[model samples]
Structure formats: structure tokens, C-alpha cells
Target: MTLVKSLYAGIATASFVLAALPAAAEDDVKIVASFSILGDMVEEVVGDLATVTTIVGPDADAHVYQPSVADARAVAQADIIFVNGLGFETWSDTLISESGTEATVHVATAGITPVKVDGMTDPHAWNSLSNGVIYVTNVAAAMKEAMPEHAGEITANADAYIAELEALDAETKSKLADLPANRRTVVTAHDAFGYLADAYGLTFLAPVGIATEAEPSAKDLAVLIDQLKAEGAAALFVENITSPALVQQISEETGIVIGGRLFSDALSERGGPATSYLTMFQHNLGTLLDALAHETAS
Candidate 1:
């Protein structure tokens, strides 16, 4: 896997970027997204207008993805590429350059103000549904520009998709509204939930930092263990893209209940609970509410 580079400053994206891209010559509007979540968002907006390909597959980690020959070939043939750009896919720049492709790389998290933790930019913007709306809107706008013939259909699809997102956002807020300030503490393997916590009135804790590849030092682990024992986490969750060992260890030490698995960085397999972005969010919300709201693990 490729080690993600340092934080980037100007992570920008637009509601659209394929302004000069010619209309689909044949019916193939090939798009390459950086990861599974981004790919699913693109699919929702583009509908069947394009064939979306994801570089990082389900249950995979993008923070340390090493692009393979197959990845290069896909990018080389793609007309457009979407990435989470707040330094999320730090390996992307090298991959796109080496792919020898002229495809336009669009930053999905373009307009959303990024959240930084301990001075490092947090790249998991899609954790917030408001920002998620921006991601698909950007894809839809670019798609409309690239294929004017399907503009009407694209707009309709985007509208419906955005509505569902907004409805769910409201629902999640309502479901979590009564969670007291004290009960909003969420613990996980890494700091991937900063955006989600910010969006839903919850506080998140993790042993390591944002990138799963960065191992936590003994000092860091000790401090976190002390903190958890002191304040206590409402529930512990294991993310799909990360190893469950750290969370299990933490659970054993703290005796905090392990709330079922949460899909943080990736989706699940074809028949699994979280196969797409929407289903992933729904599953995560249900899991958290069940664990945090009711503490059902006992």
C-alpha cells in the first residue's frame, strides 16, 4: 500500500469541472473515483450515464493504498477521476501522473470547509451528509456539462439523491438530538469520526490519528486508555477499513462495550449490510443509536 503523504492546503473542488470535456463520443462516460464511498456517490448522481470505477475496493483502506498496474490502466482509460482531496488520497497525485492519463481529476470535497485535528487536515469529509451532498452535486454538475443531452435526467437524479440525503440528515439529527452532552462520546480505532461527530453532536475518541497507517505510540495509547477510563466512552466501534485488534484491546482494558462494526472508510461486500454509501450511513446511524442510545450490548 502507498503511504499517504503529508497534509495539503488547497483542497478544492467545484460544483462542476468537466466544462470543456467533450460529450460522450460513444455511450461510455468512464469515471474513476478514489475509493468506494466516492464511487457510490458518483453512481447515485451519474445514474447509468457513466460507468464508475473505484480504485480502493470495499473494506479497503485508502490512506495507504498502493496503486497497482490495474489501477494505472483504469485511470489511463478514464475520462474523469474523482478524489476526496483534503489530502485524503495523498497517493492520488503520483498515481494520476504515472497513469499517463489526461483525465480531469475532480476534488469531491471541494467547497466544504475541512476540519483539522491537532493541526492536520481531516480528509473524511463525506462523514458529514451535508458535505456528502456537495460531493454528488459536483459529480452531477460535471456530468451535465460533459453530456448536455442528459442534463435534464442528471438534474432529476441529483435532486432526488440530494433529497434522500437531506431527509436522512434530518432524521439522524432528530434521533441524536436527545443524546446528552455526556453520552455523545464515541470511540473507534482511529480519528475518522471527527466530521461525523461534528455533524451529529457527538465526540469521538481513537487510539491513533486520522490515517490508519500511523501506529499509535505507547505514550499515546497510555494517554487514551487513561482518558477512556476517566471520562468513559459511550460505545466502542470497529471500522470496516481498519483492524479490530486495537479496538478489541481497548475494549478489554476499558471494559467499554464494543458497539457493532461501523463502516468508516469503506463499504461492505455485495450482499453485506453496507454495500453503498446510503446503506452504509443508515447502518452506521442505526448501530450508533442502538449502542449509544440504548447501550444494548449488555
Candidate 2:
């Protein structure tokens, strides 16, 4: 009886220790982002307080991304999920439903006034630094709500990041001001830059609609080419997320020089030019200015 009692006590102690082990190991909050850009923002806000898993990574097209089993698993395990939520991730709703996670879903673009084109809300609001401030605010609030113990840290990080975004906004405006007004028209593979155009006072034209999944009609392409020729738009840009073939074909047809690759829907991979949000904006500005400057000089 004495030996049996001792064995039972040891089993209970082992069970208690095993249960407490998870409590000790689960220190960081698990966050899942719908894409790379939002992943970067969440990482910046959470710092070391959370582990962020991005579903659609850098240089990948989220518009057509099909979430895999691993992605669904990540969502299932996440404590919080951040999504852009302007119909940006078409697959996200189904994935979230399938994941069956009770995690809080936060739309990063909650408070911003979205620009609508053809009755569709533009999901690329992050293109404008001013709107980026709103994104950070929403992300910070979500993080605070999820992990109240780290609220102070999250707020400080968000404030610092927003300040950087403000500086980037000012710099973008100043750089764009140097371009000739006539050369301010930008043509890209898709209509991903409406927010950027609206914010920075440039005119953006695209053959295809906002979502890459939407195929551009022959009529649309013809109209865009005619408009480009009529407007004498000098620069055409290829987006990092899209195939350059369509833009290349457009350039060949119109004799408009391909300006450069723009980081439209996604950031560049790590160790690339447009790695971070700040660097992405800087690189894009430089590319536009370089091309526009050349056009103005010619």
C-alpha cells in the first residue's frame, strides 16, 4: 500500500509538471497576417512580443494565391489574424472558415476612406503613407486588445512607425513635386495605384482592373493604348507581383519605355531593394523620379 501510494503521488506530480510546461513555453502571442506587407507591420508593432506568420510572402501575388494546408494550420493556431479586408484576400474567408479558429480578425484598413473604382473598393490603400498611418493605428489597437499586458510597448512602437510613415509621405510629396506636371501620368500593368495617384497627385492608368484575377478585355487594352498615345504618357511600369509580358507588349505597341519594376501589391524579397515598407516606398519613388526625370530631359 505504501509503495502504491508513492507511485500515485509521483504520477500526479509528473502530470502537474507536464501541464505547467506549456504555460512556461507559450510566452509569445501567435499572430497570422494575410500577406507580407501586413506581416511586416504586425511584426513592427509586436516586436518581440509575438511570432508573426505571413500567409502570402514577399514578391508573391496574393490576388491569386490559394492558401495551402500549412497556411490553414497557421491560421488555426493563431491567437490573432490581421487581414487587409477590402476583398484583397479572396481566399481568406474560406480559409478562415475552414481553419475554425476563434482568433480575433482585425481588418487593418478599418477607418480609412477607401477609393472606389467602377464600384469596387481599392484594396491597395497601403500605397499611400497617410493611409498607412490608419493601418498602423488599427494594428496597434488589435494588438493591444489581444495582449493587454504589452499595450504600452505596442503603442510606442506604433507611434514611432507612424512618424516614419509621415516622413516618408512628406518625402514622397516633395520628390514627386520635382517632376513636370505633364509627365505625372503613370501607367502600370494593373489599376493598383489609384490610392497612390490620388494621394500624390499623379494620374494612373492601367489596362486591367484592380484585382489581377480580373482579365483585361481587348477593348480595355485598346482603349488604354489609345489613351496613352493621346496623352503621350512616356513611362510604363511593370509591377513586381505581375508578369511583365502584358506591359512589355503594351510598351512595344505604344513605344512607351518601360520605366521600371514597381512594388505594387507586395514588397521585394529580403536583401532586395524594396524589402521593408520604408525601403519599398523609397525605391518606388526613386524609380518613378528617375524615369520621369529622363522623360522630362528628353
Candidate 3:
């Protein structure tokens, strides 16, 4: 009888322990970001608290990305989805609808006052370090709400990241201030740098509008050429996500040197100069400054 009782007690204890094991093991919150830059921000904010899946990857154009069935499946499984709202992702609505995800959707650019161009909102708000802070904050808030158990960790991570963004913003302003006022005008393939221009006191002119999918009309090209000549812009740049054909043509016609590639819409691949948000900003600034400084010397 004593041996039988001990065997029963051991079985009960084993069952209890098995039941408690799952409760002790925490599940990671699943998060999906619309593109690479936002994915980096989400990763920074969540640390290891969540698993981040990015749809549009490095050196890819989010403006023209089409979601696949696998992407929908990932979205459906996400606990939260972060998008860059201001009409940046044209297919985002369809993806969300098709996935029928119950996930909470957060637009990273929620509180930003967007720079408008040609009756359309420029969705590249992340180009500005200040707006990058806002993106991080919104993501952190969403993470806290989705994973309340990890709210403290999310908040701390976000605070530290925002501080770094603030420092980067200060550094950008200082660097831009070093350039001559007349030399601050920049010409690129697309008008994706409106927010950066507004934030850094530079004038950006492009032949094509915000969306790279649309080609520039001949009239638009003519007008941009005239403006470039009038503004005496000496350096032209091509974006990472755009074909350099147009800007290269412009550079040849106008005798403006082709400055190195700028990571405008998307970041470079891993181990590249503009891999992260911070590195992207630094790389762009350095590239621009170096090109313009060479022009100044000449």
C-alpha cells in the first residue's frame, strides 16, 4: 500500500510539472514590418522580445513591391504589423485585406507632418532623423501594447534608440551647416528627399516624383534640366532603389559629376555602408558632403 501511494504521488507531481512548463516558457511576439528600415527600427525596439519579418528587403523598392502568398501567411501569423502609411505602400491595403489578419496595425509615420509634393504626401519621412525618432516611438508603443509582459523592456529600448536618433539629428545639422548655402541644392533621380531637405535646410530637385514606378515626362525632364542649370547644381545622385540611367543621363548632359549612390528609399545590403538606419544617414551625408566638397574644390 505504501509503495502504491508513493507511485501515485510521483505521477501527480510529474503531471503538475508538465502543465507548469508551458506557462514558464514565454512565446515571442511575432511582428511584421512593411519594409527593411522599419524592420530595423522594430528589431531595435523589441530586442529579443519579438520575431520581426520584413516584407521588402534591403536594396528593394517598396513603392513597387507586390506581396506574395507566403507574405500573406506571414502577415496572418503576426501579432502586430508596422507600415509606413503615407501612401508609401500601394499594395499594403490589399495585402492586409487578403491576409485577413487580426493583428494590430501601426503606421510608423502616424504623428509626422509630411512634406507634400504635387498634391501627394512624400512617404519617405524616415529620411529625417527626427521623424525616425517618431517611428521608433510608435513601434515601441505598439510593442508594449501587443506584449504587455515586455512593456518595460520595450520602453527602455526605445528610449535609448531615440536618444541615439537625436544625436544623429544634431550631427546632420552640424554637417549640413558646414556646406555653403548656395551649394546645398541637390539633384536626384526621384523626389524622395523632400523630408530630408526640409529637415536639413537643403533644396532637392528631381525629374520624377515620389513614386519610382512612374517615369518622368519629357516636359518634366526639360523643366528639371532648366532648374538644374538655373540653380547651378554641380552634383547629381542616383538612389539605391532607382535605376541610375536617368540621373546618369542628366549628369552627362549637364556636366554635373555623378556622386556616389545614395540610400534613399531603401538601405544597402548587410555589411554595406548604409545597412542600418544610423549608418544609412551617415553614409548619405558623407557621400553628399564629399561630392559637394570636391565640386567646391574644383
Candidate 4:
């Protein structure tokens, strides 16, 4: 049998323990994440504990992700897998099957009650810092369970990470508090920021619904343009995971200057501004504030 099958078989037969395993078995702790953003979060808590890999790379749209054979092979070898769940990767089940991986699947969204994406439950719970805290907790718990000897260390790391996330949650609310009720309306290319909007009291608007797979109808765009003009919208933004052409068209039609690009569904590649979740949130907030401040000035 393949090494993956062997690993799963061993996990099934053995009981949980807290001691270190053999040196040769160290590489067996492979982790597969659904996308770049989730991979980043998993890495922060797990640190150097495992070989982390992501199926959807930077700036890839997860809503319509199609996993490749290579991705399947990677998943098949992992000791554990982390998924955002809540229907984020619509084809995740198929990916798991194709991989033939019996690795335990851990849903990072375990405790997050996600916001609705255009009335339907969306899987992008990481948009909210509170939900991010839940994700880190779940990751730490899964790691500690799988590698028992490291339980105490993993728990301590998770606690420190939780403290940072809590601070970020507070900062988001504080940063957004300056915007008046009417000026709280924000528009973007897709419906990925429902959780962020809900958490910080912003009214989110998107011509396209839950996923970027759907194109905005011309009628919808016209309606959005009219409404934005009437409301004196503070800003419009393009998502990092989506093409900018549509957002540019909307900006041109509405005469609203395009704010800086926002990190929505994905994280930036290494060395980029939004390499981490906290940086991504701060970048988006700064962009919004700059645009709104400009509106106030003019």
C-alpha cells in the first residue's frame, strides 16, 4: 500500500499519546490547506511542526477551484488536512476523494457562525477576526491531538495567537467607528466581505453575489451605478482574487475613484503587503479610510 494509506491505517489503529515519535516519521506530518489564506493561518499556529501545502495558490478563486492530480497526491500524503468548510471550496469533497486520502479533515470554521452570502451561508468565515480566533483554536487543537507530545507547546502558541487576533478585532471596530452611519456603505467586486461588514457595521454592496463565478448583469450594474451616485458612495474597490476590469468599469460609470485593491478571498504571495491575515485586514481598512477621507475633503 502507498505511504498515505499506511499513515491513515496506523492512525486508526493507535491510541492518542503525548510523546515524540521516531525521527524517520517526522516528515509524515504533512498538512494540506484549501487555499493560501487558510494556509497562512495554519502555519502561524503550527509553526515548524509540519510540512504545509496549499491547493489553491495566491489570488486563486476558491469558489470555483478545480483541484489537479498533483494537488490530490499532496492531500493523499498528509497526516491531517485543514479546510475552511461552510461551502467555501464547493469541490472540496471531490478533491478529497480524488486524493484517496483518509487523513482526518479538520474544519477551521468549527465554531464560527458565518454570515450569509447573499442570503445563503458563505464559507469565508475568516473575514471576521473572531472567526479567525476560532480557526486558530481549531488548528491548535487538531495539531495537539495528532501530535500529543507537543500538546502543551501547541496550546501556549495558540493562546498567544488568540491574544493577537482579539487585538485585531478591537482595532477593526475602532478604525471603522469614525465613519458616520450613512457613510458606512462600501462596494466591492464580489460578496466576499460579508463577515467583515457584519463585524464592523458596514453595509456591503456587490453587483455579483456569493461567488465570483457569476457575472453582474448589465441591469444590475446600472442600478448599482445609480444608487452609488445617489448615496454619494465613499469608495469602490476591486478584490485581490478577482479581475479589476469590472470594478474599473463601475468606477468609470459612477465617477467614484477606485480605492486601493482589497485582499478579499486570498492572501498575497510571500514578501507582499498582505502576506498575513492581520496585514490584510489593516491594508483593507487603510484603503477604505483613505477613500472616505478623500470624499470628505472634496
Counting clashing residue pairs in each candidate, in order, gives: 3, 0, 0, 2
How well does candidate 3 match the true structure in TM-score terms? 0.89
| Alpha-carbon runs more than 4 Å astray in model 3 | 1-26, 296-298
Candidate 3: tens digits of C-alpha lDDT, residues 112-195 = 998999899999999999999999989988888778888899999999999999998998898888787777887898889999
Q: Give one digit per residue, the lDDT tens place, for model 1 in 186-287.
A: 788988988898999899988889999999999999899899888888889999888899999998898889988999899998999999889999999999
TM-score of 1: 0.90
Q: List the residue pairs that clash in candidate 3.
A: none
Candidate 4, pairs of clashing residues: 18-148, 18-149
Candidates, ranked, TM-score: 1, 2, 3, 4
Looking at candidate 4, what is the lDDT of residue 124? 73
Assess every candidate by TM-score: 0.90, 0.90, 0.89, 0.88
Residues 116-150 of candidate 2 have per-residue lDDT tens digits of 97888999999999999999999999889888888
Assess the local accuracy of residue 99 in candidate 3 as a C-alpha lDDT between 0 and 100: 62
The residue-level lDDT of candidate 2 at 119 comes to 89
Write down the worst ten-residue block by lDDT for model 2.
3-12
Off by over 4 Å in 2: 1-26, 296-298
Better of 2 and 3 by TM-score: 2
Model 3 CA lDDT for position 51: 88
